[model samples]
Target: MPEKLTNIRNFSIIAHIDHGKSTLADRFLLHTKTIEERTFHDQVLDAMDLERERGITIKSHPVRMHYDADDGRTYVFNLIDTPGHVDFSYEVSRSLAACEGAILLIDAAQGVQAQTLANANLALHQKLTIIPVINKIDLPAADVDMCLEQVEELLAIPRDEVLKVSAKSGMGVKELLEAVVARVPPPETDPAQPLQALVFDSVYDVYRGVVSFVRVVNGSVKVGESIRFFNTDLTTEVKEVGYFSPGMKPSASLLQGEVGYIITTIKTPGDIHVGDTITGYLRACKQPLAGFQHVRPMVFSGIYPIDTADYEALKANIAKLRLNDSAFVAQPESSIALGAGFRCGFLGLLHMEIVQERLRREYNMELLLTYPSVIYHVFMRDGSMKEVDNPLHMPDPSHISHVEEPMIKSQIIAPATYLGAIMNLVMDKRGICLKTDNVDHIHVMITARLPLHEIVLDFYDKLKTVTRGYGSMDYEPDGYETSPTVKLEILVNSEPVDAFASIVHADRAVYRARMICERLREAIPPQMFKVAIQGAVGGRIIAREDVRQLRKNVLAKCYGGDITRKRKLLDKQKEGKKRMKEVGNVNIPPEAFVAVLRASDDKG
Candidate 1:
């Protein structure tokens, strides 16, 4: 039947954030009879409430289905789902590389944005058979003709080649499936070759450590075979091989041109990684199949607990969390103030937020997150090197002797009216403009080389504010470069507080320092003892504030009571004294530490 389903389609839905990629995939799942139609009024494959509530897919997953074409024939559809955040760009690339085709979803009303262009570029780079689909037609803001024109002009494809569909209303989905069957070629086959499967994405199962999702490029995999992961020489016997049916129904061994899961009892999550090659152990190491590449994380930030007591708990939770999420990375990091957190790399800012939110929500651990810091290589006085994780830990420019910072190639799209504002903001952020072009109705595309550290904190918010929420910024972390920066440390009572340190351009250091002081004033609670706040530079205080004492002391008294009340009052005062934080000879309330630590987040 149809060459043993080798002529079947294996494709992924890829798009920018909030562009209805998952929504459209849900529609496909419904139309294909994979699940009861519209069973999930909410997102279908976004099985977790966390994912649906956030309206973003954190983990990549594949949903299997069969679509009946107007030709009255069936095609097995392996719809690979990918993350929309740039942090998962590698994951997106891996998913795109697994398939022969990709459906590019463009919002009709908003037209093309920064990420749309990016994902389109990645698809074209992988030489994918792209079917441009314009979605969200039900909205009054829909501009089908305009978005199609943008796609045709930007992607250099024919306008008529693009398909129009309303993913939300489920209109045009059947035709879209037909277009996929007609235009998208079946998986390339060379069944005789030795088995070489690409592990595009994977997750950990409680019973089995990692259930890796693989796309078989050649041969076949059966149960009880000796298999080896490319990156890891670690060999394991395949416990079972299962292919995805219309909605994960059980099917025996997955053959060439199939999407399926492999249950290997690999001891830990570290054994499995995305984009790894899973090949049968043979007489010699067989060459990898046609498509695969290494994916690099573009952004990084440190995650630490607000309370030192929660440090181990945070570590345990992060370890557990990373098992299922192949993208989340963690490494030990220590700051003078924060002690130990993780310097974790991500694909983008959205990726960082997702990890942080999960840690807070899922684990119920309150954390004091320093401004997300990018990786920077610094040359020290001892002729050695250190990778700066937290900007707070960045040595003084003088002590650093010489410093280099990371820079990223960024693209910004904003309305023509805000071009000036955008330009000014970019320049202020130390961005070196690369190119400027006018597109749809004075929409301007400006490319700039920006310091990764500059935008590590709240660049999105900053850009949005500057452009009145019309700024669309897209960046893939490039690499470290030499740049001028000053590391300003925030202090309490002249003692260096590593949590308050940040890296800023030399010119902007003063303003940032003052602003940090103001934030500390808001964040640092009025304490039992007078506490001083200072922003220090080169071990010298640049900005300072003195938080006054609590309006009332730890006075516990009864209006009409016996001497026993006095004893009770003494006991409370002793207990309260024991709970106080010693900040440079001042006994601050326990809540004061939490208030100050969580203050930065509040301002955020």
Candidate 2:
């Protein structure tokens, strides 16, 4: 290898949540003295307050460090920190595409987990060099031998090659770093080639325009260079080129095999794509690098402003958020009951929640989200197939031939003792167990196929409940399967509430309808006239709940009135009440929608 390429190593840490990926990165920053001890903090790479508060890495952060090895040589290490949640696996994949190697970190106490296996397979699929490392070895329950056996059995890596380290206590960290230097190979590319930098991520800057994080695969990019995005064919001038000192440290240029950022003149939200390739305008690469796959959101919901007048503000906020997150998709969709809103799609339930929280916190916008739904492939009798994510878009039952819902192949790792409970939980979610394998003496791995709709709700919470918080699950799309489904709509005073409608499985529709109706009964305030909340499938009503009217005492002060007069007064009051009921519209509060969403997550 040439001296220039041999001194630079690009690698990322891949692991399940809470497996100390961020902590390990922190240790790397400290050991290399990238930051002074007095200025350092835990989870240094997790810059977002939400990330620090949640104790999870939501975004993949890259930083460069100069380390002095025991061999009396200095090397440049580019470490990309990635999120562990399945929803952000796209972030993991993008970060991995920019790296030449990955540190496959496993929790010593938890051993091999579902996501552990998932991330390992991703790295393997990318053909990247994997360094198996056991983390948290200082814990009392750390079973090094069991973890080693599981890694060898599941990941097919030899036990002798695995390194053990305590990221929290800094034990064996130095040796682990040495192993990374020795095991992970250097980037192999020629600087003489045409400029072909892969854009892994980008964030919209109010002042600097779009700041794109890129990995220069070949040639180089510097300030004042005009570049074109291969995906969109949009040309822009580079305003600044810098590498992350963990902070933006401007450099003269970004060279080949280096990970850095390039600030462009473009200010639009959707101009530069995350996985797009950047090439010089006059002299471009013949072909763009193989970028990451485009993200397909699995869950869809309606996001509306709590205050109708905030619609414009909400739209701007969502667009800004989308600039940071390409996976989160939104389009203008209005609901009669909820007014103007956006139909937003998310990778999963957690991803939806995180986006909501970010909007509320960062943008200070009060938002309302409808019941989440998955895209269904509806095959019509005329041999036409239509994709439906919103219940409002569902065709009439008579026009539909069959409905096919998305399915997922799920992997669950749990204690062997919880097998029966876990199996029963899966069964309740309309899942079929395919096979099971023992990871060690006490832990077992279970693979199952389940409808995506069933698990979208409270499946994860229920799995944790049944397994006593010992079970972890990871899943991937497994195409679609024909299923009996219907559009379930909630009607308030005989008027359909578009925001509360959903496409539910026929077998579970009745249960889900009843749950939502009950929640509405509790949430909707009583009016002068009675309000009826009904859940209906097409024209048939399946569940109903009535909000009792607040009756007024018309005869309270008629103690001395004649019987006929009193009777006349009572009749007049009845007429007034009837008139109010006929003309009045039910007002569904924000809390009512929130209650219905909470109820929608109940196991059906």
TM-score of each: 0.87, 0.94
Looking at candidate 1, what is the lDDT of residue 402?
A: 70
- Compute the lDDT of residue 221 as modeled in candidate 2: 92
Candidate whose lDDT is highest = 2
For each candidate in the order shown, give its overall lDDT on alpha carbons. Answer: 0.76, 0.89
Candidate 2 residues lying further than 4 Å off, grouped into runs, are 190-192, 552-576
What is residue 23's positional error in candidate 1, in angstroms? 1.9
- The Cα RMSD in angstroms, rounded to one decimal, for candidate 2 relative to the true structure is 2.4
Clashing pairs in 2: none
**Cα lDDT of model 1 by residue, 478-593, tens digit:** 67777666788877766776666666666676676777677667666676656677777776667777776664433433666687877777687656644554523533333444
- Model 1 stretches with alpha carbons more than 4 Å out: 245-247, 283-285, 289-302, 306-309, 332-343, 381-384, 391-401, 521-532, 548-584, 587-604
